[model samples]
Target: MRRPRSPSFQVTPKGERLDSHFISSLSRPFYLLLAITTASLVAGVWRWQASPSMHGAIAFVMIWATLDLLFLLAALGVLYEKPQRRSEPRAWLDEELVLWVEGRPFRARASDGSRLGIGVDIGFSELDAATRQRALDLFHKAAIVTLRFADGKVLQARIENRQWGPRQQHLHLGLAYRFANIQDERYAVDLAFGDSARLQENLDRRHQGKSILGALAHIAVLAVIEGSKNLWWQLRNLWDLAYGAMGRTLRHGKTKELT
Candidate 1:
């Protein structure tokens, strides 16, 4: 006789899940940009004293940098900020499915209930041979189903439909219909969820793979600014506190004599 599966191997029901790492990943770029801007401002200030002619350009950079810093800090705070907990009871589509009407997190299930008689009934009679085979192919692969209601609410659920027997034929059929109606006006499927880490990894790869030309352009601009500072300051004296004070005293003495 086949042995029953251990409790450790058994699938456990999961409650609503939140991706705190995703939230942190979203905010990281802003902090990085802020740090770069701060470094540029410090370098600009040091160059400003020697090259007073670039004061106008430095002031412009400072103003824009300060404004951007404030905006980024505010956005970072808001992104990291947690939403207020809602005490309202959750709406359930079924025992396994929870309706995510609000922006709050909702439970997701691994099983598709269409095979369990809870969803729309679909059979071979409903679909042509080619379509039925295609649907079967889809079932063999892990798929994410996203459903949108008439009221603009959306729900995403992950399922492996291939495990279901003939009794659950409608589950994949319903998924097939939903997939077909994706572009239709009446059926609004917004997004789907699969491997969370894979998605985040793709985003990170795209973010890190900055265009070579774009990077070169940025380097070129910085080079121009630094070059201009170096060229302009070559003809100018370094700002000396004693020299400035002496000049101010001489100007005062000249004014007194004239008076």
Candidate 2:
């Protein structure tokens, strides 16, 4: 199999080294539809202003607001979604390790934004203890990141501080799609939960789903605020017009009485 050339990325011959979490592809059509809806609403707004139709402006506002919300839900679904990994439809692990040497699985350059991690697939339980220990040594030397599977292949690597309070640490790895022969078997791996503080972090994550979800929540709030502003401004304009007419009537009546 042709090996991957980058340190942070591992490419299986059959499986794609997907950058997206899981069902990230599902939102493409959703976002596209939203974009179209948003554009149409904008065009309608312009036409409404030129034609001075209250009904047309109201229709545009309603359509734009509803579709914007639907788009939010779609974004949340796609970004935070994760699929079963082992059942991933790729047949790359059937062959035994050709050479399990202690080396960078792939070459990586250090970037300023985030710390890079090295990913190593550990499916060699059949190998002796010495070899297993040696395989782990490569991860230690460069202070690179690794995803150590009990028998699971290299899934993915991420940029993390790799600290778990005073002693243990958390591993930030990417999810991989491994194709297994057994059709009935489900692909799942238990992720570790760390210290009390880390436990809180995990709990928060569980409630909110993931980082992507948190971001989505923030975005949704902003959109709501903006939509509220649009509705409020329309109401304000009507109120001002009503008050102006009332004041004009009172002044006209007083002038007529004086005359």
Candidate 3:
């Protein structure tokens, strides 16, 4: 007689994939660069228009507006592109143990003599006091967990407890702590609630006692740059509108489209 193969579940990456904090942290730098580039381009165009042989200020303004419109369209295209989907097959989950996987809820009980184990302790009691506390803290705050089993299979799951409350928290905490302390390369626990790089950067900032102050400065700078950009665009639009009206008036019932 042949042995039966264990049933496998599919693992999919889903829900809130982007780290907002990471994006927020970079906003200041992004706006600063944009402001510098826009200013440089405007200065260059103004200098060119100042030359006696070049087109008038109106034409220069129109040229800059055209460039701005093109840039906006390109940005929209990139922003609205379809998001890529990634998934892993043959990822097994013990439904009884996992409250939810990747934000989707499901329930299942382990079958008799099944090899599938969920949240089973590898060795939590053996860890030292400080390491144990760190693991506990990690689990308590964890929204996502990556688990590796003894057989070298990897499982990534999102934790959600709707009914069990503190019991559920304790269960997951024990499992996560145990897995985190595992020494073997084959079995591991990885928790992700925020971007790792951002977290490290924040830690570094805190060590230097500049985290809060730096964040406030970034927001202030971003606000000023963005406000200036918006005001410039509004003025440009008004000028273009007036220019169009003037051209139509001069042409006597004929109008030209500005590209």
lDDT string, candidate 3, 199-250, tens digits: 4754575566547768656555554554445445545767999999988787
Q: What does each candidate score in C-alpha RMSD?
A: 24.0, 22.4, 23.6
Q: For residues 101-192, could you state the per-residue lDDT of candidate 2 as single tens digits? A: 24444222211111112222334345467854554454344333433344544433332222222222222223222323333122222122
- Please, what is the whole-model Cα lDDT of each candidate in the order they appear? 0.46, 0.43, 0.42
User: What TM-score quantifies how close candidate 1 is to the native fold?
Assistant: 0.26
Better of 2 and 3 by lDDT: 2
Question: Order of candidates by TM-score, top first?
Answer: 2, 1, 3
Q: 2 or 3: which has the higher TM-score?
A: 2
**Model 1 C-alpha lDDT per residue in residues 96-211, reported as the tens digit of each score:** 33323123222323222221111222234466778667655654564555544444544444442233445444442223323333354232222122335544754675578658
Error of 1 at 9 (Å): 33
Q: Which candidate wins on lDDT?
A: 1
Off-target runs (Cα >4 Å) in candidate 3 are 1-210, 253-259
